[model samples]
Target: MENTRFNPVQLRRARIARGKTMTVLAKETGISRQMISNYELGKTIPSGNYLVKLISNLNFPKSYFSSGQASNLHGATFFRSQSAATKRARDMQSVRLSFQNDIYSVLSRYVNFPKVDIPEPLDMNVREMTDEIVKSMAMQIRERWGLGTSTPVDDVIRTAEVHGIIVVKTNMTNDKLDAVSEVIGGRPFIMLTDNGESSVRRRFNVAHELGHLVLHAGVESIHDFTTQQLKNTIERQANLFASTFLMPDEAFTESLLSTSLEYYVKMKKYWKTSIQSMVYKTYQLHLINDDQKLYLNKRISWNKWRRVEPLDDMLKVEEPTLFQKVFRMIVDNGIMSEADLLSELKLPFDELECSLGIKLNNKMAVSEPKLRLL
Candidate 1:
């Protein structure tokens, strides 16, 4: 506390990380709410006992407060169901994303992760996009990435990781926010809610955000669009991207022999897509009529497959392993010890775990044979 200067941004960031409002933090620390506001605004810096109260209540290390505010990245955060997500929830996830971004930066200094790879940049004019255009673009990505010929994508998560996207499952407070994507320091990060969703849903979320990164992020300020209708339109396009990307058009139409739920349960085994998505694609492909689509919906509701589909438990849940593998490589190889990481990042174990998605399962006790701090 003596050498480290208090960063007001860090204080606000930590407050949101713990999902604390100003008044709630005031209650926890027994500090006046007005003074906490002043401290965060940088109108006044806390000294003596006030500082100790924040340290005790927040559980962040002294060095964290000293670190300068992170620079805002160029790309805006793209959130699914923006209208449905609460501001507080968005704030918490954004801070968590920034932390994970920083963790990525620190780790990249020791090793290289995949760089952003796309066949080409997408059409800048989002207004001109249609279902056909989106489908064509999805096909282009499938071919460019060598996902395989008319076959089910072996692993969308693995494809993303191999092609230079870092995907992490986030512990989202809001159920509405399925996923978020932002370009932090030129690196794209996609965060999905780790809410025990089915494997197909999780895969769709990742693909949707990848759509944002490819279709919307650099091309425009999509998140800042003023109207909800436009947002929904863009979101629909991304969904098309995901659906087409997951279930290829020609192959899907060929294999969708029946719209029956029992038949789709087997399709789920093959396409690894939810029955709903497959049915929607079938309708879009003109293989099913409106009446047929309605009948399928009724059957889905009757079978209770609307929310949790068949084979959800049976199919393997896809997760990102690039970070986990790299982190172990660094620590196990003595590139950086656990204590050194804790000291360097200046975050408590839980907060670090929140961002990095790794559980070290140890307190910050001073261990023997200390390595040089980074």
Candidate 2:
């Protein structure tokens, strides 16, 4: 077969994802590092023999180098690997992946998968009741963790992982919803942060799903698995979970007696939540009476600004994403490599730019070894 022309930029990015330095790759492929550098920089075209060696060593398919198509797996878009434009999305992907692991670990203990128990339509009222379930589970979970009423936002997640659950984050195609919590064939799983949400929003999405895992586990066997119904149920459950998990009823009431909106807003940093979520929980827990709830909602615009939004709208970052986290864990643990990534994931290089969101250029070239005179 005639060799297809390879994109040098794409080849280099794949190598980095594999965590193999150019020196190590040079020794394995028996190619001079300078030649590899030249190929990567588009300074020279690689011969068929060179391409075969590269394809084999890098574990990329011959097609990846020969054709310019992006990896079809996960529908990732492959831009020119040399461009740094895709970095921001990839950075958020990394954080989302880290938190997803924490979510999966937490849910796995109670059940193998994350799913709701009921088969009925999860209307607003049923969804809203998730707060009650989370409050109850939050108390129990805290006791299991050997804590008092209130738990730090991060630690709450850590404790959940100790129980076993699978948390996954994906870039949902549209403005569908914030998150989804459910079970697949008796196991528990949750997907959070449909595309365009902030890290803080992602965090809340996980917590809301956790609420479903803990409180809605009883109803999983009956769920119909339709999109709208499932979303409504899970969102309500997660909202309840987020509320109770962030602020326990007893402590919230204690704080509510004296704290104002500004105090709660200030306290948001401690809870790792937004001012609006605190208000909803306070009202639900009855810490703030009806009058206070109405006043707070109007004051905070809970109807409009309920969940946490990002502070910085302009900053862009491309770090590892949830998929990359799994990749990193397996690679770091010696369980997988770049070959496995390509074969198993069928991922394309352009998508890698979006999925990993890292920048590469000719500046960080690998140098050839100098021959020493004996």
Candidate 3:
């Protein structure tokens, strides 16, 4: 059959993500290396028989061959193809979400945190707006949450995770979006990166994605954060959410009377915000002039402070990931089988094995070695 309709870019992306050179993949699948290059460059498509062999050996499903659907599911950025690896990655994500949701439901019973209200984002150009509105909204959110005193970043992360948020590792290879939040129905679901980013930056990414779930629901807009274009009002709202959540102006202003570097240094300890964030927030609150803002920005840039710092210095709470907890519960309770998950998630058997990093064939199937051999 003809392979002309498939996308070469997708093929290239899938191959690269799996870290397999054309020669390596060709050897594994018994396909010619030259043909692999051709497929990746869009010069030619694989025959039906060859394609099936590729998918089986690659451990991907038939759906991965389609560029449009697979690419869209991945937010159209990093992984371009629907290779076996991609399908497994997506399945792992879904399983993780399933786990997170269950844990969140249980945690909600004990936590009394106020639920964030979803509001329609005001229709204004995000780029044109000043930072004051963002600051004000953040203050409002903090007040609503009653986080009056300073809290550790670990506490904040735990609380968000309990509310169905999952943190992901971000790298140069992710979708061009700084963050993406997806929540089914009205629940707030978000994915963030620890990336050793400053406590303040991490908080901002979390709150920003949360803002999307609450504010941009039911909207059709581009979510890419790389392009230099006028952002939709919704994107602006999310950024505002992130800024305000990380640095509440009232609490910040109330505690400080001076703009000296010493004062900022002292406050940074409690707020756990980066010096740059403190400077930006200070400028946003009109606590400093444009000159100070420029100077501070230059200082930060010169220091190359954008690099993420290790969080080893901070306290780490035992917050199990959503999927892990849920999968454990299901397995422990005999609520489902490995087969059930594979079929529900549309993952090939081996892909499931790779994604979970567990020996499912043995562990998932072998009936609990007769605990009572009475």
C-alpha RMSD for every candidate: 3.9, 13.2, 9.5
The estimated TM-scores of all candidates read 0.91, 0.51, 0.58
Alpha-carbon runs more than 4 Å astray in model 3: 1-52, 56-58, 61-154, 164-177, 185-187, 193-199, 223-226, 231-236, 308-320, 337-374
- The global C-alpha lDDT for each of the candidates, from Candidate 1 onward, is 0.78, 0.50, 0.51
Q: Which candidate ranks first by TM-score, i.e. highest?
A: 1
> Candidate 3: lDDT over CA atoms?
0.51
Residue lDDT tens for model 3, 198-261: 4555565666665554444334434333323314354555666665676555667786677766
Cα TM-score of candidate 2: 0.51
Weakest 10 consecutive residues of candidate 3 by summed lDDT: 75-84
Query: What TM-score, to 2 decimals, does candidate 3 have?
Result: 0.58
Q: Tell me which residue pairs clash in candidate 3.
A: 60-84, 99-322, 99-323, 100-322
Task: Give candidate 1 misplaced runs (Cα > 4 Å).
Answer: 1-4, 218-223, 365-374
Error of 2 at 199 (Å): 4.4
lDDT for each residue of candidate 1 in 24-111, tens digit (9 for 90 to 100) = 9999999999999999999989875787788778877767777766545465687766667777887787887887776787788888
Among the numbered candidates, top lDDT falls to 1
